[model samples]
Target chain A: MKPIGLKDLFVIFLKAGLAFGGGLGILAVLEEEFVTKRQALTREEFLTDYALGRIVPSGTMSALAADFGARFGGFPGSVIALTAMVLPAFTLSVSLSAAYVYLAGTPVLALLPLTILPAALAFIVAAALRLGRDITIPSVEALLAAAAFIGSLVFRISPALLLVGGGIVSMVILAFTERAENPA
Target chain B: MNPLQVALTIMVLNILTFGNGPALVPLLEERFVTMEGILTVDQLLYAFAIARVMPGPANAYVASVGFFLNGLLGAALAMVAIQLPAYLMLPLLRLHERFSDVAGVKRFTRGLTATSVGLIFASTVSIGRNAITSLTAAIVFVLALVMAYLLKWNPLLSLALAALAGLALHAAAPSL
Candidate 1:
């Protein structure tokens, strides 16, 4: 690809942002537009960055931009990628937030929680399942998920503790798995 | 009611957690819903649902909370606080390749990934308990899930269907 400007970068992520709601299956679009068409990043690089993004706070989209943006255009590139990533969605969120605040106390809007809440949970479940299918491959991770669930829901363990302890356990497991595989 | 506090809360939460915001919804409930009574569980979940339907990072929901507490300025401040840190950290992320093989980094990263999965599942349970009550609601949830998982419909489309189902159900059985 020729030298890509921040304007083009912004447009690319703006299109991705538009897909976020119902168009959440945006990887294909991204693959076609950025990877194949624009030659922005190779497929392998995008996939690796996406996986790395999962372990970060912002999740896949922003992570992709942050990771590759630095490589592609240095610090300025990363800034543009991150800003473009949020612009469209942030605008939508602002409007939705305003409407939510305005309609908060009305009788009719009260029904929104009763109705939309379930849908929200359902969406979370769906998104989780999609991601979980990837995480559960190691069976041990599934156990961790189960353990975490019990600890949080039944035992009421502190979220911070569970996360920290779980991370420690996983680290131990990774070390053992590595040693077993390589015998080093 | 304090915009600064809300901004600070978002920044702290984002800084502390290693994954999506949904995974840590319980902490949010403790702080905003129960302790402060800033918003009821229903309102909070509803706002979260709105955030879901919108396109963006999960942290954008902080703006929704800010909007509830103050207004547009609150939303802007909250968003800036949560996101500024991530941007600042980008440089570290870029430089981390030098330490990629360090045992401590490997352990921290892998461990956090597993823990994040568990935390996310836990949040699902917590949110589900609050969201599901009536049979109608349960049905809507399952339908939405099927729509998302099976049909692979757009989230906006599935959510639109769900909103319609909610309205219809409400019209049919007001008590439910």
Candidate 2:
């Protein structure tokens, strides 16, 4: 695939910005769009960018978009991607916030969110399932997931702590597994 | 709701979240309500609920909360502050190229990625407890799961159907 230009970056991120509901949940779709469809970024490039996004000190979606934009269009591309990535949600959020404040008093308005809630809930659940099938292949990866779920669910542990802990735990496991294999 | 305070507070919240938006909703609610008293708990939850209906990540809800606190300017400021970190850290992508291929980093990210997926699952449970209250709600949950995951329907459309179901359910069981 040829190197992507600023226009491509803007259009791609804008489409993503309009499509994703879950924050990190959009990574899979992004891989599909950029890697499989556009052939702009290879799977390896996307994975590296995604890992960088996870370790970076911002939102994963924003970090990934910024990195991809930088890759395609340098600093200006990053700016365009970030702006396009945010425009749709920002518009929707501000509009909804304003509307809710003015018009959410009626009984019908009250039930609107209640009705949307279940579907939204299920949406995330399905996303988790989809991501699970894609990422959690190894037993250790599965263990990390189970630990994360139980820790967050039962102990009220924060997700940040769980993610950090899982990283450390997986690192330790990898070290041990490698050592065991190379015991010469 | 001072704009500066709003900006600074949201900036700090984004930093604390470390880019994981959904995980911080409960914390966001507590602080917005109890610490600042800018919004009621119900109001905060409603803001989060409707956030799902929007296209961006759920964190875009922060913009809505900003609006709830102040208005358009507040929303704009909060959005910038929350998103600033990512752009600010763009230089780190260069550093990532140097170390991303290291074995331990690879292993650690494998863990983090899997764990992140679990966090998404937990988020569903958290939201499900609120949304799936009755048999009707359960049906919506199941129906949405099938439509979204198996049949590949647009999520917005599924949510629309759920809203109609909500209205119908309300009409049928007025006391509920």
Candidate 3:
């Protein structure tokens, strides 16, 4: 494998950031450009790439960019796509961070938090609901979720315990189900 | 502390943990609570509230907290540090299809997802405990929950309504 240099990394990051900050709509445009017009990959390939990206750690868009880049131009392509995805957001975040400090302690600053907190809570609740809808929880799974919720809320159980317990239960259930289905 | 070191630490934290961003909160609190001294627990709660209200990613609030500490430089450092690792790691993953498809890796991810949900749940309880002081606040919480779960109302809109209700209640009973 060719060694990636500092200059190459920087260029890739810069390009990915720019593309990412351009927003999801722009991503759709890029998909059409590269996947459709360029015939780099088919729609099924693109969808699989994106699904894998979402299922894996990190942001879905960044993952997709990396997958596409790797496919198109090997390591260099992956670097370019990742850079394009992140650069825009990175630049904006840096600029905003600088401006935000200057504006601190103002009434606007106070108001900003006031508006943001409720929205954030709402987002959290919505996310939980969305996740719940997606997963096919058996009665045991539902019981586990309820137990975790109650343990966290009522008994002050550590979140770590709930997570570990859930994992163990799921693994055991999966193992038993697999064994039962394929009994010799 | 060197600005670059600070940035790197945040970047590393973001990468090591899953991408939920807020996952770094407890760890960040443990690290910076003493060194920075600018963010009191109360202020941290307030900042968290503000981040929640905002339309964008919850981790974006790190900028607000960083700004509170060492001004623009701090905020810039914090944002870069938090996001940089993810930016760097995503591309790296593309090259190793086998690495991505490993069974152990999938199990680890599934475990992480479960942990993240639990953490979020814990955070909700903590946040709710802090914010829901009065009868009106409790009402707002229940309403928000119903709207989110049952009515399927958009979260941002529900939040806006809750904020409006809070503001209106505060105005009506200034003494309370």
Candidate 4:
């Protein structure tokens, strides 16, 4: 397939942004369009970008877009892809926030919180379980997770500190293990 | 909230957030809900709901929270702050060999991922305190969790059913 231009990228992401469902839903659409349908990016390349996006900072969805954009269209492409992907949702969220400020207490929309809160709780819990299920018990990663949980929830420690501490511990362990393996 | 302060806080939050927007929830709740009390838990949950209902990333909820705190500028700053890392990753893409080859990056990512997962788990309790108010709401929460986690149904689908259940419960017991 030929290289995809900026306009095409924008249009594709815009369509994705407007599509129903959230981040994962948009990812499926992207995979279909770029990997399966257009064959612009091979499945391997697409998956690598997706993985790298998750590894990097920011939300995975936006990072995926930026990574793909940079791959296809350089810096301009990255900006355009992210902007298009988020434009629709940003507008709606902002508009709703504005409306909610004045109208939240009103009877017709009163159930908004009652309904959304529990559902949101469900969403948060499910996300936690889904992510944690992959972690092996008694591993360093698990230890880090347990430590972070206790520190943040029980001690109210700063999350930044926990994150830095976890990363450093992981890096040190990895360094030591690698050195032990290659003592030539 | 001051716009500059909001932007700074979001940038820090973004750095700690690994994988997804939801990972940032615990940090956000601590900053906005628990520490400063800028917004109530219900308001933050509503922002999350709006982000879910709308298309794109769930992280866009930051914009709603920003708007509630300040206005359009706040929303814009939050959006930019949250997305800043993606753009920052662009230049790093050029260093693919060195970047991915570095054991440090992989180890750090693993650690961060673990930390994020733990925080996400912690957030369930923190947010649940405010979210799970009555028995009916708890039932909705359980059902939604089942649909999303066990049945592997779409989150949107679970939320839709939850909304319906909420409406039904409200009608039955207005006092609740």
Candidate with best lDDT:
4
Query: Which residue pairs show backbone clashes in model 2?
Result: none
State the weakest 10-residue window (summed lDDT) of model 2 chain A: A108-117
Clashes in each model (backbone N, CA, C under 3 Å)? 4, 0, 26, 0
Q: In candidate 2, residue A77 scores what lDDT?
A: 92
Docking class of 2: medium
lDDT, candidate 1, at A155: 87
Ranking by DockQ: 4, 1, 2, 3
Q: Is candidate 1 or candidate 4 better by DockQ?
A: 4
lDDT of 4 at A156: 86
Better of 2 and 3 by lDDT: 2
Q: Across residues A1-184, which tens digit of lDDT does each residue of candidate 2 receive?
A: 7678899888888888887656655676688778999898778878867766776656888888777887779889988988888888889888877777777677756665446656766666766677678654558888888888788777878666777788889999988998898996
Model 4 interface RMSD, one decimal: 2.1
Output the better candidate (1/3) by DockQ: 1
List the candidates' TM-scores in order. Answer: 0.83, 0.73, 0.65, 0.89
DockQ, candidate no. 4: 0.67
User: Weakest 10 consecutive residues, lDDT, candidate 3 chain A?
Assistant: A17-26
Query: lDDT order of candidates, best first?
Result: 4, 2, 1, 3
Candidate 1, residue B83: CA error in Å?
A: 2.3
Task: Identify the leading candidate in terms of TM-score.
Answer: 4
Q: Compared with the true structure, what per-residue lDDT tens digits does model 2 show for residues B24-121?
A: 55446445764577776445655665666677665777887888888899888888877778875466766665654668867777777688777767
Weakest ten-residue segment in model 2 chain B by summed lDDT: B21-30
| Native A-B contact fraction in model 1 | 0.58
lDDT of 3 at B36: 54
User: Between candidates 1 and 4, which one is better according to lDDT?
Assistant: 4
Superposition error at B16 for model 2 (Å)? 7.1
Question: After aligning candidate 4 to the native by TM-score, how far in Å is the CA of A55 from where it should be?
Answer: 3.1
